[model samples]
Target: MASKKKKAPPPSPQSLGLPTGGVETHAHLDMEPLDAEVGAVLDRAVAAGVSRVGQVFLGPAAYKDGKAKFADRDDVFFILGIHPHDAESANGVNLDAIAQAFHADPLIKALGEIGLDFFRDWSPFEAQRIAFREQLSLARELDVPVVIHSRDAAEETLRTLDDMGFADRPVLWHCFGGDANLANEIVARGWLVSIPGTVTFPKNEAMRRAVAAMPLGAMVLETDCPFLTPIPYRGKTNEPAYLAFTAAEVAHIRDIEPAEVWHATARNAAGFFGLTLPSHT
Candidate 1:
């Protein structure tokens, strides 16, 4: 006889108790092996009260899968752009194709996962810059926000944004790892910053302080799932359902109630992504 497979335990009520109007602003569901289990994952997130998920549309493969998935849900929204690492995948016509996809799908809300990445030059740095600027221009034309990914290139990223006049539109520095001073500047300029579960890591004192002092309106919570799983779940594949841990940590750092953090961050995300918030009245 074949051995029985072990099933993952159901989410605990505490883990499932998301505050009203909670939203998951970033995650990569249906993007890879993760796609195989997305249904169960979303079922769990819904059970946990996560009302919205911002899916990302990257290169050709991601865009195709994203469109198919986008076809299935009223609750899920998407971002369309080439990722920095995949900058080489872009060409003049590919850029046109990406913008066309965004135009074709009103469900595609923003241009992003675009920016500079000097950490791994998987794609040439110049290609990354060109792709980044092209998307920024496209975003300006489309009147949509940009989801930025800056790694080992913060100054360059901000400088590029400045050059492109990104100040006129909303920009989210996703999974921000910058210090408080950078946070202050970014927040002062009215750009939003998203915090990931990495803030709860034992050594990120700077990130903790930044999260604690961040203005509620300028802050959003993201799991950056299958990557930055928070504290106790640190080594596992992150899911949107794990946002409760993230909210609890943010609440602990700010010394505020978790529900309050949930409410504010949800509102910030809904506003940033131009999604409708569930009516509190």
Candidate 2:
């Protein structure tokens, strides 16, 4: 019988040696493996050069349960929204609860990771559409940026955003993995594209090319941690600290210094989240 091989430990973000200033615009720190040691994880991120992070809560309960964890973590902002996977549960009561959560928590920067997920189709297409529109209305009402999660439904997603009047709005296309053409379309609509760790994969040449083609000002970096760990860290559990790898990969694609991409994306994320980037020591 063949022996099972152990996975290699990921390189520390500190080893990458990029300047501190990177902002991880998306992450699920409240989730398992990460939630257990969220404090240590954030400390590692600080050492890794990531100056700030966005913690996404999938629902109101998640928001209520996890908000206390980051209470003292000034660098960690909050994003609460319903995922398409849970679209069917987006009833009026739940939407109201989401709204109330936003009203109660000024730190909740945006409404998102909410859009269609045709790839999974975990919920009915109709249910996803209704939930998406309802949440978009809430976002518009709350006047916060919207973070999108479109999978195998980009065209439809764009169509919906257009129909619902999100043009030139503070919208972020999260986990973008398209080519330059789609990237251009997104930029033309005046929305920001968030580049995820997948950009470091050799198999995602299109994503690399997209990074090259996108204007630095219109792009941001994200770990989407607990998922999409970059390159050398590909098989390990991802954390905000690993955003340096994604930034370095983006820098390589754009033929610029990693620090440049790091800072520029930080600004983009700051603008999207409606917060100012603090001066780091």
Candidate 3:
């Protein structure tokens, strides 16, 4: 009989050599079904050196729940907006609700995860465009940064932002999947791009190349948790604790130490959200 294959040990903060107080800039903690375990998840994230997390809201329900759940935690921040896939549901009333939440919460740092998602087409293109524009307008009026989610609609998204005269607004392209040229354009526009756990996949050479070409100042790291689980645990449910793996891979791609990627991305995330970094000590 063949011998059983040996299982690899799970990753730990020490094993990854993660820098202290790195930020997991984008996660959907409210979307996870295990509500009771959310605290444990965040605790694991902290133990893994991810001291801060940006919880993103895709709709009104998530916004309400997230606001109540993390309202008092200084370690957690928020980005609230209707996702492009839910654009059809983003009527004036709902948009107002989102704006109200933004205005009501000082911890709500940006308005987003909003942009084009032609790949899913869960919502009509026209509705997506209208919602995108309206939220962009809201961001401008509120004088807050925007977090963008462009999937298979990069050109259209860029064109829309440019036409709306928001080309210079503070923008974070979350889970960026664009090529080097697009990355260059994003950085040139003074927008930041977040690298997700997908970078750890061996076949994702395009993403790797994009990360390699990204300037350190323009880069931030995220898990986009409950999705995009990094390698060595690809099919497992993702949490912020897995961010160190993504950071390690990014460091490898950039030919630098993981600590450099962690600190630079942490600083970039802080500047983008206008939040002060907590001392790791």
User: Number of the top candidate by lDDT?
Assistant: 2
Q: How well is each residue in 1-281 modelled by candidate 2, as lDDT tens digits?
A: 99899987767789889776779999999998999999999999999888889999998888888899998888889989999999988888888999998888889999988999999868999999999999999999989899999999999999999999999999999999998889998999999999999999999988788889889999998999999999887888999998999988898888898888888899888888977676752
Candidate 3 TM-score versus the reference: 0.95
Against the true structure, candidate 2 reaches a TM-score of: 0.95
Q: Tell me the tens digit of each residue's lDDT in model 1 across 55-142.
A: 8767656787556754666778887789999888778787888778877878877788899899897989999998898888888887
Off by over 4 Å in 1: 1-16
**Model 1 steric clash total:** 0
Candidate 2: lDDT over CA atoms? Answer: 0.90
Cα distance off (Å), candidate 2, residue 256? 0.5
What TM-score would every model get versus the actual structure? 0.92, 0.95, 0.95
Q: Which 10-residue window of candidate 1 scores lowest in summed lDDT? A: 10-19
User: Would you list the C-alpha lDDT of every candidate in the order shown?
Assistant: 0.81, 0.90, 0.86
lDDT of 3 by residue, 1-281 (tens): 99999987776755786757799999988875534577888888888888789999888778886567775567889888999999988888988888888777788899988999989868999999999999999999999999999999998988888887777679999998767888988888889999999998888787788889879999999999889888877898888999999889899998999888898899899988987776652
Q: Lowest-scoring 10 consecutive residues by lDDT in candidate 3?
A: 31-40
Pitting candidate 2 against candidate 3, the one with the higher lDDT is: 2
